[model samples]
Target: MSDALLSLENIRTDIAQYHILKGVSFSVPRGQVTMLLGRNGVGKTTSLRTIMGLWQAKEGTLTFDGADITGAPISARARAGIGFVPEDMGIFGDLSVEENMVLAATNGMPDPARLEWLFSAFPALRTFWKSQAGALSGGQKQMLSIARAMIEDRKLYLIDEPTKGLAPAIISTMVGALRTLKQQGATVLMVEQNFSVAKALGDQAVVMDDGVVVWTGAMAELAESSALQERLMGLSMEAH
Candidate 1:
């Protein structure tokens, strides 16, 4: 994958005495969305943490934009244009929505135009701009989490399960915003359990099992094959 924006080859990560990612490998091509699909506890989140430099990879190489960043610190990786939206959302609960966005901006202030664009994409952010982040509903909090990450332009974004527990309406809103991001040529590697969402947004798909990559190819191929989905993901697209 010469055109990949991020590549993890034989990545192995351990949390304490537990070995998590065992030789996981995948490539996120530039200016496209790659869906990291798998069952729960299959090292999907662990892989994202390793790429973001939150977890140290005991072995393998992590390359971003042709540069080797296996040993780079988390801050260094961020500076190198890698943005992450962890499954936990990683927001400041005590702060106001506006304060949180300001903190995510590199210049200590949100650019007016970009802020307006974001507010347009996520009108709820504008509706609750001065409210405490912790007080927002679950869906609203998820919106704020994604908004913070998109506050700055980056080469690649690693997001985990953006629509895990949202209602249909909220999920639709998220899908719309992500579609706009894709149109803007942002490269994203995301872990999502919702097969519908994955099929809607993913250009490529990487399936993981037992801490290793089990399948990789076009999302359309996987979406069109129920047998493949059942074999790799343990459930057919119809079931999801």
Candidate 2:
């Protein structure tokens, strides 16, 4: 993709003696959401970790906004306009919600307008501003994790399964928040197991199987074809 904000070319990652990503390749187009879909243990999480430099790629190139960052440290990548929301949510349970957001801001303080916008999107963050993060519900904690990443504007966001294990209502809230991000022209590459959420927000889709990319195309195309979804992901879209 000519307008790709991030591109991974033949990325390979290994954990000890185990190979996780076997030459994975994909591009995330700027100002759009790209869905990284695959079943459990197919290296989807490892791919996101490699892009964030949490797990170094043994081979291949990582280009962000036309600059090669394959060897860059995690901090350097974060400084160079990349935000990551891991599968664990990476929240500081001991801290207050307000404190967490403050810590996520690069300047030590979030912009008042941006904070207000986030509060509007996730009202629970505002309600629990001074409350301990550990006291929040699972869904609220997930909202805090995503809100922290969105506290500072970045060129791209790598998010892992924002709606996993949530109730339908909570998932709807998450979907709305992500739609707001898209409206603001944020570029995101997300790994989501929920087919409904993927179809709702993804502009492009990249499917992985056994540590390698098996398919890449428009999300709508994949959504419209149950056969393609079944072939790539081992289940039809309706199964979700």
Candidate 3:
């Protein structure tokens, strides 16, 4: 992929005595949403951690924007315009919503334009500005997590299951926000289990099984093929 902003080639990782992400490889295209999908325990989160340098890759290479980042530090990755929204949301429970967003800004101050856009995208953030993050609802917390990542202008965003445990309404709002991000020219690599949401937001799709890529193609093609979706997702149509 010549236009890939983030490329992972033969990536491998291990945890203690357990080996995960065996020879995983893929490329996330610039200014588009690429989805990583698979069953549970299929090295989804591990791959993200390795890319962020939270989990060291024992082998293979990672390149971001034509620069080798296999050995880059976590802070360095962030400084290089890579933003991450972990599964746990990674928010300060004790801090106010406004305070959390302020802390995520590169210079410790959120840009007024970006802040206004965020408030418009997630009105709850504006409403709960002074409220602690721990007091927010699940959907609001997810919004804050994403808001924090977007506080800074980044080249790529790595978000994990943003709709997990949220109501249908909130999920709809999240999907719209993700689409807007792509429209704003921010490349996105996301891991999601919801077939509907994945189809809605993904431009490219990669399916992983047993720590390696099993399938890769356009999201529209994957959405049209029930057989392929079942084979990769390990679930029946009714379940999905």
Candidate 4:
């Protein structure tokens, strides 16, 4: 974690009586996109939730920007420049897209330049500015969720399965938006099952199984080795 912007060491978490994370450890490098890839129920989402303070770590430490944030509140972590996009795409369905964005702004006002850039990245957001978020399509809602998180500048983003169940066309849009995010030098920790999207955006990859890291390497390496992909994720990238 020498140059890491975020580091997690021996993190342990429990949901009810079930131990979800078993001493998970990883480092997210500054200005790079790190992919967390694994089969379902492997603690990938749990790790992100713990990092965002949604679930308290029963043991171990979480550090962000050289400060220990293991015990910090979710709001404090957000204030420290940590942004989260949950697997469910947490959004205010009843609110207008514009209103949702406004609410996500830290100071009650978004930077015009950033808003402009986001709109360009996901044009449907600007297209449905006054519409209710619930009325939008699946891909549009995903765009809104990610756009809302970008309403303010963030140092690190924890995004879970942004392209979970979308059409190929919409996935392409998501890939474009993520490319824009990478170009802006955003530090991202994303949980993705889509191998194509992970390959396109990931600088590094972490493969997990049964709540522990099984492999850590470059995304290119994972992309190139079908045997490794099958061993870790239980499916080859070609099937993805």
Candidate 5:
């Protein structure tokens, strides 16, 4: 993209006396997915939270569309076109699928055109529109979480893990959905532990270790080089 939608420069953060993010830096181009890859406890989740202002970073500059938002409240960031889907999926189990959708309806109406578009992309969500969120399957809940993030005219998407517990087929479906999101021009910053899922859809890979970004490059580069993956991601694959 010619212009960046969101950028994080040298971010440092701490939580409860334990230092987490250490000078993390990366940026998402307009309409592209930037995957954050690393082993568990590498502080990938913390990076997303700090970006959302859920955990204030001790240092770093966070800019959204050229405006400094390092100190902006989470709600303020949400209002400024930042949509977040955490590892937990952040679904309201007490609410029905439709109710969950309704909770996010505001300046952006539940416009028939948009809803139809989303429903077309995710038919499962349409099937369980009236079902309670807690009653849905894991894949269904993931769909709901992603759908809710896309409810508004969101400029950037901060998605933690969209394919954690899904079956292979469902993972493919989620990958397809992310491709559609990219096609529709949504800037995405995703954190994925599943190497296959990230390799399939991510444009670039941001490899983090011990709370700081250690490596970054095109997805193809990450996939083609096994040694790089093994060293940075602790991934090992056997010939099939």
Candidate 6:
């Protein structure tokens, strides 16, 4: 990779009494999908939060596109073109579908091109455009959340557990949308529990353990390394 869109070097973050990230470092190349993988309680989600500035790093540095942003505030970080979609989906049940999208954005107005592209890919969102978010299904809300992230053409995306509880068909839709993002020149760093999905979408994979990065390499390595699959991911590669 010539230039990393975003890089974390020796990043250590804490949440109250828990030291969540311990010197975890990795670089996300522009225009590639990087999946962060591990079993539950492995700090994958926490790492996403840290990148968003929801959790500050006590030690180490965060650099984006050659600038040092280790001390930037949450809003400042967002202004610098970092998009995040958390596991909860972060939809306002009481609001209309469009309103939920408008509310999730930290920037000014949501871009029309972004919204249009999103609706076109996830046509289900267009069907429920006038409906309230509370009435929409889980998969619809997830689509809305992702659309919210793309509103301003952010350079990087940090998505957490995107496939959790989604119907298999809907998961396929989500995967397609992510592929669209990649084609449009966005770097994606995703936290995923499902191996098949990650392997399908990710160009590179990083495995975390107890707040530290235990493995980092291409998805091909992830697919072939049985020892890593069993040890770090806690998965036996016998078969489905």
TM-score, one value per model: 0.98, 0.98, 0.97, 0.97, 0.94, 0.93
**What lDDT is reached at residue 121 by model 2?**
89
Instruction: Please give the clash total of every predicted structure, in order.
Output: 0, 0, 0, 0, 0, 0
Supply candidate 3's per-residue lDDT for 159.
95
Q: Pick out the ten consecutive residues of candidate 6 with the lowest summed lDDT.
A: 231-240
| Candidate 3 local distance difference test against the native | 0.92
User: Per-residue CA lDDT of candidate 2, range 1-240, in tens?
Assistant: 539889999999999999999999999999999999989999999999999999999999999999999999999999999999998999999999999999999999999999999998899999999999999999999999999999988999999999988889989989999999999999999999999999999999999999999999999999999989888888886688
Please list all clashing residue pairs in model 6, or write none if there are none.
Answer: none
Report how far residue 180 has shifted in candidate 3, in Å. 0.8
Candidate 5 to truth, TM: 0.94
lDDT for each residue of candidate 5 in 1-240, tens digit (9 for 90 to 100)? 347788889999999989898799987788788999888898999999998989998998998998999999989998888889988989999989888887876653576777887798789888998889999999889989988887766888999988898888878888887888888877899988777777778888889999888898898888888998888867652121
Q: Rate the local accuracy (lDDT) of all candidates.
A: 0.94, 0.94, 0.92, 0.92, 0.85, 0.85
lDDT of 5: 0.85
TM-score between candidate 4 and the true structure: 0.97
Q: Rank the candidates by TM-score, best first.
A: 2, 1, 4, 3, 5, 6
Better of 3 and 4 by lDDT: 4
**Model 4 / residue 228 / CA error / Å:** 1.0
Please, what are the lDDT tens digits per residue for candidate 4 over residues 1-240? 227999999999999999999999999999999999998999999999999999999999999999999999999999999999998999999999999999999988889999998888898998999999999998899989998888887999999999999999989988998888889899999999888899999999999889889999899999999998888888787688
List the pairs of residues colliding in candidate 2.
none
Those runs of model 4 whose alpha carbons end farther than 4 Å from true positions after fitting are none
The lowest-lDDT stretch of 10 consecutive residues in candidate 2 is: 230-239
